[model samples]
Target: MTSFMEDYFRTALSKELAIAPPERDHEHLSSTSRLLEKQREVTEAETLLANQKE
Candidate 1:
């Protein structure tokens, strides 16, 4: 009975937390590129601020 209850709970949790498949690889790549662009902009801004302080 204990083993049966454990299996039931395991199955229920598995279904509840199932991972969804990625819909599109292109969308992921574009988002990653955008993130990199934002990081570059931030670095440039920091450099400009440091130079102005000197």
Candidate 2:
């Protein structure tokens, strides 16, 4: 590869890594999962109710 291409890739990668946030901790991940599950359950219940009216 040319020097320009290598420099471009390195700069782009560094910028992307810098812009991205760190990974969440275990507890945070579980909390998010629980909230998402609850949201799904609520959506399912709402859909059932809506369908029953049909």
Candidate 3:
């Protein structure tokens, strides 16, 4: 689980690094995608942890 979180963080960081300077709508879309990805990672991690508790 720790490894999974670490991987997700790394991927997010890479994506952020690769993002070019926002020019127009692309900027908004990129930001939104990143936010959604992060949210999904958090949700998945929480679910995994919860399952472990049971």
The better candidate by lDDT, 1 or 3, is 1
Worst 10 residues of 3 by lDDT: 19-28
Q: Alpha carbon lDDT of residue 38, candidate 1?
A: 67
Error of 2 at 45 (Å): 0.3
Residues 1-54, candidate 1, lDDT per residue (tens digit)?
997898688668866886654454455577777687668669867965774574
Clashing pairs for predicted structure model 3, backbone only: none
lDDT of 2 by residue, 1-54 (tens): 687797688668755765333444547567777687668669867965774574
Alpha-carbon deviation at 13 in model 3, angstroms: 30
Better model by lDDT: candidate 2 vs candidate 3: 3
User: Could you tell me which residue pairs clash in candidate 1?
Assistant: none
C-alpha root-mean-square deviation, each candidate? 17.7, 16.1, 9.6
Per-residue lDDT of candidate 3, residues 1-51 (tens digit): 998998788668756775443444535567778787668669877965775
The clash numbers for all candidates, in the given order, read 0, 0, 0
Give the Cα lDDT of each candidate. Answer: 0.69, 0.66, 0.68
Q: Is candidate 2 or candidate 3 better by TM-score?
A: 3
Error of 2 at 3 (Å): 67
Ranking by lDDT: 1, 3, 2
Any idea what lDDT model 1 has? 0.69
